[model samples]
Target: MSGSLRSREREMGVVILDGSTVRAFVGDEEVFNRSVDERFAALDLNGDGVLSRAELRRALETFRLLETHFGVDVVTPPAEVAALYNSIFDQFDLDRSGTVDRDEFRSEMRRILLAIADGLGDFPLQIVLEDDDQGSNLLQQAVDLEAAKTKAAASGK
Candidate 1:
């Protein structure tokens, strides 16, 4: 698998594939740990045990901002980036339900952060709930979050 960053130039790198395999360089454990921690905190906005799709989408927004601020070359466009994370979210939601548990959320988020650390893609993702009630809860949160982002952007904030 090819990576966005030259392996020789960076202490850590990632090789992401279309399927389940997302490889991260464990060559620098300390850096990798720190990156994962920081990324996780940013995505778990409610400090809840699990992450919603809304939270993951917000994380992607930050990723896009950072990439632009740092002048990093993005191989994927914004729409594709959104679709990628959406696809990941579906996969991470193992139960076909609506919410991802803490363990699953962390694992997928780590994979995404690893890819981003290597400048591969705008990655960060999450969960599903099985019950109709719980699924509605998650869906509401997603709608609300998306609305807030739109409003904020429209107001130039």
Candidate 2:
């Protein structure tokens, strides 16, 4: 019930979505890959076509993304934070290659998203997503995909 939440260029707003919303996103391979790949590319600061442990950790530190919950700070010890990030990095490195290639990253991301969708169940969850350029905008892409589908169906009729 908040104002529109969009990219940095647009006024910040909040949108409500649920399990079905995330399901739609994962179902649309084109939209999902494009959106998620953009994020992976940004995180691959070395331009190595893969994400190293340092790269992933740097992203977390720079963004403090996992630490703060919608402006609420959850203070954690540095050692614990490092371990958490290490575990996260390990999850993404599906092949245990010490780096997360695009495929590995994509596969891991898919699993994570599916888990989130399952957990959300039938509840309408409101969230503010940072710009796709800066952060994950999964919900926005899901909404846009559905809107495009509706528009296409209308035109076809």
Candidate 3:
């Protein structure tokens, strides 16, 4: 992976540990991608290509630790979490294909990071920044996003 891509992944809360373990860190909360994938796969009932809102809600119930560790109150009456998951799923779906494959999942991660970076005022100031370094960084960002998506898909999240 490119150095720029690696840097972006680090910025987006992904930890590339030794032995190829990829973990996600949300505000000091750590979640293993493999574990999350297993949990989500178990929730994908009906052997369908996608997870319905109901299925996602059930998955959220199982993912209680996420809320606790992340310091995010995502789990509540269950319905609320379900709704939130539905929205999240839609955002991750990207192409609105009702299913999020590896590519779409990675794109969603990039979008999430971009949103956070934008919120933090870390992005470029100008309407359009013209520079090779900036262009290379942008390319690296895209590469990192793809890597993340591939990891997520392989992990089953």
The candidate scoring highest on lDDT is: 2
Candidate 2 error regions (>4 Å): 1-11, 62-70, 132-136, 155-157
Question: What TM-scores do the predictions have?
Answer: 0.37, 0.78, 0.35
Cα misplacement distance, residue 48 of candidate 1 (Å): 1.3
What are the per-residue Cα lDDT tens digits for candidate 1 across 35-80?
4555556567788756688886675563343243233545666688
Worst 10 residues of 1 by lDDT: 12-21
- All-Cα superposition RMSD per candidate: 18.3, 5.5, 16.1
Clashes of 1: 8
Stretches of candidate 1 off by over 4 Å are: 1-34, 65-85, 109-157
lDDT-better candidate, 1 vs 2:
2
In candidate 2, residue 16 scores what lDDT?
75
Steric clashes per prediction: 8, 2, 0
RMSD of 3: 16.1
lDDT of 3 by residue, 28-111 (tens): 122223323443455568666566656655644543433443334433576765566778778767788777654554455445
lDDT of 3 at 47: 64
Per-residue lDDT of 58 in model 3: 65
- Candidate 2 worst ten-residue window by lDDT: 1-10
